[model samples]
Target chain A: MLEIKNLHVKLEDEDKVILRGVNLSIGPGEVHAIMGPNGSGKSTLSYVLAGRDGYAVTEGSATLEGEELLEMEPEARAAAGLFLAFQYPVEIPGVGNMTFLRTAVNAQKKSRGEPELSAAEFLKLVREKAKTLKIDADMLKRPVNVGFSGGEKKRNEILQMAMLEPRMCILDETDSGLDVDAMKLVADGVNALRDAGRSFLVITHYQRLLDHIKPDVVHIMAAGQIIRTGGPELALEVEANGYADILAEVN
Target chain B: MALAKLKDDALAARLAGLPASAASGWLAAAQTEARARLAAMGLPLRRDEYWRYTDPATLNAPEVPSAARFEAGDEAPAFDGIDRLKIVFVDGVFDPAASDDLALAGVEIERLALAGQADIHWAQGTYGVLEARGQTPVARPFAALGSALATEGVLIRVTGQATRPIALNYHHVSDTSDAILHHCVKLEAGANLTLLESGPGAARLTKVLEVDVGEGASFHHIRVQGRDHERRAATHVFAQVQAGARFKSFTLTANGRLTRNEAVIDLVGPNASAHLAGAAVGDGDFHHDDTVFVTHAAPECESRQVFKKVLMNGATGVFQGKILVKPGAQKTDGYQISQSLLLDEDSQFLAKPELEIYADDVKCSHGSTSGAIDETALFYLQSRGVPRAAAQGLLVLAFLAETIQEIADEAIAEDIRSRLEGWLQRHAAKGAT
Candidate 1:
């Protein structure tokens, strides 16, 4: 479903290198977890794959379903089935959450040559999705992420992931600010979308999130490179001990 | 103090070609006083503190610069969906043939041409009263010029809840026409009225709208400055609110060579509320300015000033707004926000937000910001499959949504939003820098 070959990235405006020759791959219906400490280039991988600005891919290629992803614009990449759930959801002051979601849904549909959903149809679908996520009408009506609590923001991100239904989803620190219940709720939302045709790359530092949404494989990343790979038990090992033991062993 | 030689020359030249007032009685007296005031203040100069960011050359020049009339191309005119008493003006001249009859329940509408001829009229005390009061602390010489020279307008008086809004439609027909209009509105106690104005009147337009809101009266004003890309206009609105009165005005300006809109509001009674908001979108050779002042003279009053603009391709926008809480006006609430979204590096926004509080217990806040589109937000939208251009258009509209939200009517607000969307779509084709 997704492939990264020797992905090398550096800051566009600085001389610092972020991702140094990182490589990863995930098959359809598989969920992979990448765990690392702060400043370990985990977020950079997600941003670079998402086509965010200010990052230069010095050497590497990323493909989604065998189609080159790095060369396409962000929107084109999205249409090609790549979604990044941001660690910190942006707070847009005046754009309503519902409007943003509807626009995104219709935009993707239009780009894929699919007939756009009517307003009524879209509303019904969004309401059903939001209901399971516990997002009420007021939350959907408010400006996107403006004054939203930490849990609400995370839930909103999951809501987007559900609406877009991208084949290759990158969850970058989606569990960072969520409470236990919110984590479970978000995990439920993600689990509901998991199928043979969809895959996820969940990036986090804690094993608690893995407890809710089990991963097929777990990789330990450090110093801009993936140094180790294991199963879901590796996350529990990291949480029980720490990244220090793994770093020491890997070195 | 003697006026500078350059200022004197410009003022003299501007006054030389102006038509003499053919009014009589109270109207003539008001015009006389306005002329004397204009002579003393003179037309604004580039050196003046208030005009520093804007050049007054074309506005002060003797000969009006010709502006080719714009064809709106089959777009339904603004306020077409509303049931209104339409009063049409072609090149600042009242077109009775195109206007609805000046008869409505609970309101009296009269043409300025006819109202000025009457020896005694209800508008007698309102014609220049608020303008004179607003001249203090700042000299709006252009408003004085409009008051003194304008010969076309409408006089509306509301004694009860108006059944529908009164629409003043200005049509531009001649490239060299210099149109001046002065309108006076008086709302008696407990009365309610909404005044809607639209269109680009002429190559050059100078207009003054003075409104007097009596005790418990409410007045709503919504205006759309026309889209003639080369037109030049200077408009002023001076309103006085009595006890328990309400005043709300919102304007949408798009695509003009130069436009200066000034609004002055005085809350002279307790529990009065005044709100002034505007949204402007311009591209290339376009300059729009909004200068507003609100005064809280009584206790427990509230005032809001919200202005937003979207500029690109070297277009320029300016905002100078002030809120003054006078002595003894306790528990006053004043809020002001002015922001601009510059689509390119070349576009510019200049803002001066001021707040003066004489009362000890007052809540006043003002903020001003000018910035490019939010790159992160843009990415967030684009990553959702919205095209880059469509994402930009959405963000621009979102940036201006705060000002549009100030409109009390949902249908009117929707119309305004659609118009803004149209502007964005048209400009998107031209490509943002």
Candidate 2:
């Protein structure tokens, strides 16, 4: 389970507050949807939770399984079962995706005091995962995100999330650049990895992705705070009427 | 005091009478020039600007006399799997018994001393001079010394229209207790050849190679400097490229106590091209320096120089690269990048990339970066279950893969990579325990 309590964060350089007293909690076997328009601090919440540098946490605490997540390093947080599906994946030249993924997975395992996987075993597992995700094996062999199409990059990210098998994953705009078909495939991949003891926080600008994953709770974020919280029908209301009516009521 | 002075005087006299050679007219002249230069400049002291990073005093000792001949022992060492034409040099002397008469259809491989005077004259006329105008001050001592004592080397002539890649392997093994001066190699026009030079077991060996590529010719030169630990070696390669010719040089300096691989490439003709790439791994108390000088003399020419150095423990590494675009050389594309990674705090690197362009139309840039390994990447790998050493090794390999991947020969590149990985593993194990 992950918990964010009245989190207020600001940029380190300019002291401009981005996330203002936003509170959220998600337990295992639950999916939370945070829908917001541009400049709504949705991505900021993801970065703050993932322990990215340059974000100053002013007066809030983020805990994963009762462990202090905000104080941990980004990679340490990742090893601690926290995953962020980046809105735009980084392009690392001269590093193969398979090599990077293997390193990441093995690093997490080592941190957990687990036995490492051999090259053969890792290859077999990754190839099987690739087939289920509709990802070409050759794409995994190429440099990470280099020369890949936008959709392929997004798919590769999901494939990484699946490979890491984090306990709590924050999907930040995983459905933004994907086409209708790619969106369905990526949603299906995420759903396949879903289980009772795992949770997901799907952040999106559209309600289309939610139609597939079907979140248990829907929250509308405005300016720098979450203004409204409702069940799944809230997504339908926002989709049909838009956030303008909600923004008016919240302001 | 007088008795002690007498002993010192006797030692100096013995050193002076040490049977040094003045053979080969050009070599004699070069030695004379070097002695004069040494008298004026003296042995580069710590105060010299060019030698500031690497002190020559630590390596300087009374010069030993060059050996006259390499004595042949029982059987030569076996190099069974390597298919190239093996040219063996024992104690700095060329061995015909070990060398196959490379009677390829269009290529010519011969000892430089045995080559006809006309051919030697042609080579000297083509590539002998160092184009002294822009030569570095640090090179003065070595150039003078090499020019003075280099008597024999290899001359490889690939005739125009030849296709087979000529492999020239220089195997140096010391038989007697003497220092060796082996100067070898010359490539001719339109001839495409791949030259692999290695110093297997050399003790105090110095080999100088002078290469000349004719118009429209191509040369692939790979130098593997893996001498014995006690050996103090230096290999200098001077290449002169003509119009429409191409020259690519790759150097791997993995093992040596004190090794310096210096290359001077001159783009003499219009539209000529040259690629100089090298990777050096120095651990222990070893010291390695890779210095390159690429000159653009003609218009519309291209030259690229990439050098990578990895050092551990108290080992030291140096990469000094210079790109010079002359006044009339317009539209020249010259790029130089030198990077170094120090694995320990005591390890040191001095990488300086200099660019001097006199032509406004030229695009010349040089960058030098030196840093420790990326800790974030290290932690990233470590958190993924890779042990600390394995993670560091993988990161170092990824860092060096940029340079190694540029090698055109798959086998050679893989060989170099495996050797580097092995070295890293050994160093990591040492650190672990």
What is the per-residue lDDT of model 2 for residues B1-433, given as tens digits with 9 covering 90 to 100?
A: 5534543443344336334544554444444554454334344444555566665542344543232222324423222234566766665666778776656667666565555234234445433355232245344445444544445566566665444444444444543233334343455656677777765334555555667777888887777665355455656777888899988988777756677667888899999999998888777767887778888989999999888888887778888788888889999999888888888788888877888888899998788888887665554343333566876777777777867766787877777777677768877888731
Worst lDDT window (10 residues) for model 1 chain A?
Answer: A86-95
Q: Which window of ten consecutive residues has the lowest lDDT sum in model 1 chain B?
A: B1-10
Clashing pairs in 1: none
Estimated TM-score per prediction?
0.97, 0.72
True contacts kept of each: 0.85, 0.25
DockQ of each model vs. true complex: 0.82, 0.19
RMSD of 1: 1.7
Predicted structure 1, TM vs. truth = 0.97
Q: Give TM-score, chain B, model 1.
A: 0.98
Report the Cα lDDT for residue B288, model 1: 95
